[model samples]
Target: MKKAITKRLATIILAFMILTLCLNYVLQVHNARNDMYLDAKNKFWQINQILKQNEKETEQVKEDLKANCLIRAKAAAYILQYRPEITEDQEEMEKIARLLQVDEFHLFDKEGTLYAGSEPKYFGLNFTSGEQMQFFLPMLKDRELELCQDITPNTAEQKLMQYAAVWREDGEGIVQIGLEPDRVLESMKKNELSYIFSLVTADSGTTIYAIDPGTYQILGCTDGELAGKSITDVGVDPGTKMNQGFSARVNGEDSYCVFTDGDSVILGITESNRGLYKDVNSNCLLTAVYLVLISIIMIVSISKYMDYYVVRGISSVNQRLEKITKGNLDTKVEVETTPEFKELSGRINLMVDSLLDTTNKLTKILEAARVPIGVYEYNKDMKRVMATGRVADILMLTEEEARELLLDHVLFEKKLEDIRLHPVTGGKDVYRLPGEREHFIRMNTFSNANSILGIIIDVTEDMVEKQHIEKERDIDLLTGLYSRRAFYRKMEELFKAPEELGHAVILMADADNLKKVNDDYGHENGDRYLQGIAVILRSCKAEKQVLARISGDEFVVFLYQCRDREVLSAHIRELLLTMKGSTVELSNSKEIPVRFSVGCAYYPEDGRDYRELLSLSDHNMYQSKRNRER
Candidate 1:
């Protein structure tokens, strides 16, 4: 029988081990595929962002080229209107070039022959002659049209140049205007495309390549040898239509790749899926070997467990249970061979003693608890059966009086009605007795068998102290307004919401000449001046506004969700007038006028950032003070 049990246990364990190995293999492969797919998706998104940025930059460059071309064309037209008769007048032409802000000027006939140019070396070079033929041939065909070319090498100097041309307004010939390369380099210096498409090679042999769409050349690649090579050389056709994460063979290796079409470049990310999943297969094999070793160990262990101890130990435990069931609470098993069985017997003996001890301890704990606790049974009327631990002291009554009051059903119902609209058995409720009490009682009620038990504690002083501490932290003692930290925190919350900030305005003010007042009168007079300014700010009474004394001599105001900008401006104008007329009387019966340099910045119009808006307001305040001084 024992051998049969051991064989059954081994079969069950072996089946579980097989299931575990299969599940682990599936999960690992699934997770690996998921990770690879997410990585590819992220790379694709990055490529899209880079392409968008490139488009924006290219558009800006086009705008600059158009503006430069227009300026050069207008200059050429002006020079044509006033001709100097000498075709090769180098001194006159160079002067015109400097006035036009161009590197050189070329005058060409309708047949594309250069007549005069700023550079003496190109006095007779024909536009249709040599390297400039392909670009200038079009100008010869359309003599009246104005044109501008992208960067090209200057024939005379062999330096990069940008040129624009327009027909002489009299239709006599074409005049060409050239811009030096230095003027175009600033707009053309962005390398965001190369930075975005740099190669990323994963440990699993995944490789990324950046390809130029115009030349089909590899711009950047994980494979060093492939750089500067054509995509076709690496077996990828630039014109091939492919979806994202398409499975195909790349470079004669099984892989997955995707193409991201950009403004001037094509981005490709490829992964060798076969190389990535090989580790998952190896892990499965390793796990199977471990399971085999563990199965052998457990099978041997189960054989020993069943043969020597399991059967006899279970029989002894059954006998001990029968003795304990027959009113023998002290019964203990002594003939246990294995440690598991010996502990099992010891636990059974301790369980009975624990039950008896728990009952005695519960009674003692109830009587000794400092907080009052009570139990009441309900039938037609409620009766308090037990009360303990300062119940009479908290109730301010004798024990007999407390019991009599608790037994009154109508009085209990009234108290419950005052404390709770809907009574929940386990929820806490606070109740105050009919008196000017120093403490408030907190009670938790629950139903137990046929009775209700309540545990109560007094927690009055804690609530009062928490409120007092919070007030001290949030309020500024000197000005009776919000503290600087509190004002900043509130502003931060407003900045996170765009709509809230849109209707708000920030006001920053500085007390003008506070140092003069302190030096002439005293520091006490300076304090009085600051206090008087605070009073003027507090008298505004605008709803939903926050005023704070943010610095020693500076105050800030946040006017939130104003109804009208003009009304707010008008109100500020009135406040400034009031400030000019207002005076603070000193202890020596001398009156001093209050003046402030005030500035205001509107949110979503001046700035969306809190620090930026504050700085702007402060700058405006200083500007106002400077203007007044002037």
Candidate 2:
């Protein structure tokens, strides 16, 4: 092509300006719409990251549920050791099942025979009955043993259950509890296709959809209106290779679309292309007229002013538009020499802003909805910490501390080590700040020689709730006594004191007629019998005496630091005298006397261990009962 020389320099400049605007507008329209599909791909990647995180979270939640199962098993064992009335009471055990949030609750005797449970049909089942039952055989032998099973089908009903078992601390029997995995099932729901769609963040006009690979029907869609519609119904060609970007008539409008490779789910992204180029198309006629007018005016004004001011402003505006078309949207047409040029610059800037504001909007959405964690980088080469968003908040650092931590290499290394464990709770790989208030943090790091990247998560709410729940679990609600767990904890702390610890005594008591009271009256009246004894013992309780109902018909007392054996005996005699006339008020308004057999074994005198002393006292009480019967 031959270059045409303009008779006037103004016409030559006018032609160049016209050519620049046309090319700028064309590139802006083509590239801006293509970006929508790219965004879809990135959004899909983000969704995959979220699902992967959910998988890890699901495993953690399952582990927590298992620990909960163990705690519940221990609780059941505690009740059986202390509440004898429910030993063979199927109705009572069923009530306990509800209270413990369990589907099945069972108790096994020393011989590994299941004598009782919430379900009466399972009574008389033995450890040798099935593999599921046999799992507890070790618990029968090792009284300190604890065991839990994975999600598996139960022996009889074949229902999927998670079971945990613990041997009674008193060496009586095994207590077990089962759950149906409701929490785990709920967590598994996050893996669904519909759930993945919910997590996706996409462009304003873009519609993300999951289609059945066989039927090509929409399984799930971000655009609610397109749900249940087939690809053909949306004006998309079923035979088209959708991974490549193409123009199509989607829902009566021209759109740019890209789809993933087909699988059980085929994901596709579609965004209207018409509106993206509407500004360029609508301004074409105006631009043509402006070009003609500019030629006429430039031919008239041929002075140095026109060459310097007019040409310079036009060139500057063209440069900005070039940058804008190349995706530098922040570039503004700021030429301001002449009124006409200034007004033109302002309108062009506004046009660019209107066309690319979706980028700005999407950026804002991501920044605002970001969650508790933030990406943190440990630049090993620089020995500096680099973080974005709320990493400082997750790390519980102030602006000053965060700056210092980033600046000081030794501090950064120490901070890394500090976060590797909980200081107060001794939990590995958990970060904790224990002070007037406690903060829990969790972070996982991946690294190369150059840097370490971490995802810092705040887990204070979970840790705090666990601590609170444990406090609530340490006491028996019915008797207002220390729960079996609390009782043992207290006893252990005392026993752990120095060896110079003075003489103590262990007293074991059994409700001699508790079973008869339940049979003659009701379990309600039987509870009253236990309560009556509890009140009597509490009234006789002196300083340093730890009392707890160890099982349905059993109670234990720890008398700490007695002055002498005579004093301990006198205290026991006083307790027996106090309980002599204690009575339970029955539902019939009848008052019945509470009769119980009591025995005592001195600490260091009877045996060295609490369990051994308990066994000796228990034998002595039963022996006295046998002698009295004779």
> Best candidate, lDDT-wise?
2
TM-score to true structure, per model: 0.37, 0.42
Across residues 172-225, which tens digit of lDDT does each residue of candidate 2 receive?
A: 778889999987888888977678788777656678888888899998888877
- Residue 238, model 2, lDDT: 79
Best by TM-score: 2
Residue 184 C-alpha lDDT in model 1: 46
Model 1, backbone clash pairs (residues 3+ apart or across chains), number? 0
- Model 2 misplaced regions, further than 4 Å: 1-7, 82-85, 90-103, 110-113, 124-145, 152-160, 170-172, 199-205, 211-218, 223-243, 249-253, 261-265, 282-301, 304-630
Which pairs of residues have clashing backbones in candidate 2?
A: 81-550, 81-551, 82-550, 82-551, 82-552, 83-551, 83-552, 84-552, 84-553
Report residue 617 deviation for candidate 2 (angstroms).
51
